[model samples]
Target: RVRLFLDVLAAVAHAHNRLILHRDLKPSNILVTAAGEVKLLDFGIAKLLHDATVPAAATEITKAAGRAFTLQYAAPEQLQDGDVTTATDVYALGVLLYVLLGGVHPTAAFTTAPLDQMRAVIEAEPKRLSDAVLLNSAGGAAAVKLKQARALRGDLDNIVARALKKAPTARYANAALLADDLRRYLNDEPVTARPDAIGYRSAKSLRRHRLGVAAGSVVVLALTVGIGAALWEANEARQQRVQAEGLIEFMLGDLRKKLQPVGRLDVLDAVGAQALAYYAAQDAGRLDADSLGRRARALHLIGEIAERRGSLDEALRVFQRAADSTAELMARYPQDGQRIFDHAQSVYWVGYMARQRGQVPDAEASFRKYQELAQQLTRLDPNKLDWRIETAYAAQNLGVVYLESSRSAQALKAFVETRDAWAGIVEARPEHGFELGNTWGWIAKAREALGEFDAALDAQRTKIDVLRKLPDADKNRIVQRHLAIAASELARLQLALGRYPLAGRAGQDAVDKFEVLVATDRANAEWLAQMTLARVILAEIQLALGERAAASASLDRVAADTVRLRSTDGTRNKWNITLLGSLLLHRLALAESPAPQRQDLEAYLATVESAVSGGKPLDAEQTRIASAVELALGDLLARDAQPAAARGHWQGAAERLQATADRGELPSMTLLAQARLRLGAKAGARSLAQRIEVSLYRHPAYAELRQRLAAAAGAAPGTP
Candidate 1:
């Protein structure tokens, strides 16, 4: 059964490497297959890092601190919104182990209380094992069976208690450590489990000795002289056993009160490393492959934390070492395919993180090998939504690679295929609502790229509605995302028809929502860039309303912020550059001076045109930037007397911008109409103008746009 659990732990650890959080883990979720192997099941409430919905701002409201897992097995922070680091999983695993050995829940003996209530009791003080034994002997239903609890040969009670520590920082740093302590207890070596206090241990030891003496005295009537000797020996043996239990319990308790959380807990500073090292060294020669695999997982988690903190090089090395170590362990124990699969995943993670540095080839090769290993996982018959998702994910990422390499046609195919695969996964597994939302959202983007606006809108709407159906408590970023997409789509359609105010309001809503996110944390490069672009669009529409001063203020702010964020890391932060260029172009178009402004704006516009046409995953904010830049470029060219080129640019910009249905598209369309009128194409210009009128009337941002288009239609050709 312990081996079955060890296998389950390895599988769970592998899932964690992929950023899946198993919110429910207990004895029932752990099962033994017919082949005598353990299978971990039930990710019904798991949280995936790669969600489909547009992410929202991180607020205290969305924290997953307390509420998912069973209270009897939940970590302390899992009671409140404290720090629910991965160590919480380790705590739950310990509870599972306790139940497997003792035949009853550790906290269950105390009360069938809520997690918060249990956590308070765990933190306050623990009932002594001797007292628990006394309670059991007294026929108390509230107490666990002493004989059954003693199934664990040495220091088991203290081991369980330590792992169930209320504070995450005070528990085993991770599952690996908890397992190590368990192994030590099994081996009759010293463990970290401790009593509530030394005084408690002494009192318990004395009580046990007195009990042994009393038992021994029952046989004293037959041989008075030898009875004294028998009683003394019994008391001595009892004292030795009690002292060993006390010592082991104290050691475990001390360690539990100081372990790091599952991730690279920096607060432990060097203590985490030292404590882990101590455990590793204690049974270095005795570790089986399962033990080694668990260690590798712990090391992998540490690497991830380091990577998140910007120490990429350190993370790379750590992941490399862990992968190597796990590989060797798997080679020695070929039967443990699950752990070996996990080792392959750790190597793939190292490659995935490397992609962020623009190392395309290395990342590609890594994912390719990862795909091969993950394919084998399909045959393993993983519980559900198993390793196949990893294969699909690898495909999606590879497709992103093609997109980045200027292969839009190929990129489009990959994204579509990936989207389909995800859809199938969601369909087959509807319980993973988050995954369903994400797959649907990406599919909408793909449909939009294929010029299927209605389909795209439907897809987006589906994503939003799915999120809305979820409880507000579980909505998190999805709710805000629904609103953001709604505002963006509404603005786009309204602008296409010349509804300036409606378009303006819709765009302004997106800007306002994003701005609140930006104020919380400017450190997120992506969010900062997005906030800037949103502000630029809002300003552009404001200017179109003839609010020149307000528009100028918004543009000035965008320019200032983007300029500061500009650096050599431009490729990765390309959206920042796009925002900068678009802001400059908008400023030039509305500038009091004409000559110098036109030159600067034209240069930026040319660069953006090259980039977009060359095939990039057009980020939403950057897409808006490109649209505005092209619009300004066409207007400037027409005003400067380049009629043919002006007409060509305007026609192209108008058609492309119309695809977005953005409110800004209307102004560009009007400009295109003016260019056609100048080129002596009266019928063509009127046709385009009529289409704009009809489109505006149908838009949610329609009322303001109807007036603008109606007045434009009444005006003569070539009139301002």
Candidate 2:
């Protein structure tokens, strides 16, 4: 089975390398003939990445290709008409692997009806392989025997689950990586698919050594029976002590030192389950303080694993139990600081899970409790730097919840405290550059929310400087992405400050960085998407600086890349493509100013209308893009003397700009004023303009519009 799966993966990997998507991958498509050889068959619905004859638009391609896939074997993306990337093939392979090992399909429950099966493929999470195997085997000849089931329980379960992740980005990057993990499992090496947890490894080790332990127990029991009652009781107590010591030794010495460095937390979960089972089997009256503590710690570890896997309801239940257990331990051992800390940590996770589930009031209450606990811990150990850091983290988490609830003032106060705490930590440990950088980012976000652009810009610059000093490597993709994001933010702040030259430089730097990333990993759709966005930012800066040709070039590149992406993957890039196409049309209108063609104006307006009609909720950045498109269409229509059409577009743009301004975005306020002035509402325009600083009158992007408003208000040209 392993060799056959590996062969299938190799074929999938080859297809991905050629930028080809095997839209239908299933067990039936794989053949094993007489000589124990594996072969992959049937690429009837495969997609070519750069087929010259195929159109660039995904809708056109889909219409031509139609939907031809085996429902049971197809990936969620295939069913939903999403982009069919290499990850889609990985998902199908995961289902195949699941069925091979478990003796039943993971989605068997929903297979009775076609619509139910479709919903299952798109929305349902499959059962873990271990559970599926047990349920399917049930009193019959087990799938691959009982021993194979045991081996598949932990490492194989995690590997299959990862491949079957709902989001394509969350799945294995390609089939080769999935095969590599399987190879590791077959070689008895630690797999990367599972979380690195000491407890889980300990459990596996215990299971492997169970026969030896049982033999020892049998011998001890015989010896105890031969001895008298008093000696027998003493021997039994000593035996229990030995067993507990052995479990602890295996967990800490063998598992922790070995697996923790490799980051295998899923293994720890196995150990934790074994430990919990051991404790549960013991008489409650017989369990000592140490045994109770171990039980609580085991539960905590299991809860953490559940939380990481996004099983929030299960995590909450487990965390609460752990917290209760720890609380009981803390009461018994009043001076045990570790117990107090563990109790607080468990409670904090409970609150975090509540927040994630959107139980706002419950989340607020739990976070407050967590904060109080952390504060108490800090007070008890005033000089403990770890406790102080924990307090700061608690504040930060609380602040995030407050921010989500729109309590900006409270969030800002919490963020300031977090920043101050991290600043002290950085001063004490000069090597804590990453933590310091993150704190600066948090501080900048809070300041920006309060409309303090100057302070936010300074904070953002500090973050960028700190991030730039970090070493760049393939493993540091996250840090590199952060650096790009910081540069983008700096460009936005500079633009808001009316520093056009600085904005252009910052935007171009961001684009350069993203371009490098895309070059390094050309198959990464996410990096490509980000590169497109960086170009969009650069185009915005160019347009604002009156560099029409440069803006057009930037926008043209975005349109071209988006088209290729759509052709390669399907409609996943549709939103971005539509957005870029509209912007390009708008730029062309600007370039042909004084005689902007009516056809071009109508085309631009149609594209913008299509984007709006998509009806998906837009983020602030997307809303700004839509507003800019509207504003451009209005400008073109007005220039062409289409009064009614122009007024409608201007009104739409003004509403969007106003909505953004209401969120305390100062840059949007200026744009709203400009929109009002264009609509001949001089008094309303003047009212909005009065809120901005007079120095902003020098900004070239809106200087003429401001001058026009000034003329209408009977003020001198260029006056604020």
The local distance difference test score of model 2 is 0.67
Q: Candidate 1: misplaced stretches above 4 Å?
A: 1-100, 103-171, 174-370, 382-384, 399-431, 473-475, 478-505, 518-522, 536-550, 567-573, 592-720
Per-model C-alpha lDDT, please?
A: 0.56, 0.67
Task: Encode model 2's per-residue lDDT on 1-720: one tens digit a residue.
Answer: 777788778777777655667777877787877986666688777877654566659646654553778888888877877777667788888888887777777775534688888887776667888877767744267645566669778889988987887667556656766887799688654554643234433433344565664566777744533443445345346334533533443353334434433445445666666665665566644555545555566666666555543455566777787677777767876665566777787788788766645455677788888888788888878887778877888888888776555456778898888878887987787656666676677677767656677788889889878876765523466567767777877786777667889999999988888876665555444566667777877787787888988887887788787775555433221234345544554465456544335565456556545544643233344455556667767877777788899899889988877766676554566677778888888877777666665433334445656687778878887655
Candidate 1 on 74-128: residue-level lDDT in tens?
Answer: 6657666455554677778766766565544555553655654565535544443
* TM-scores, one per candidate: 0.49, 0.45
lDDT for model 1: 0.56
Per candidate, the number of residue pairs that clash is 16, 15
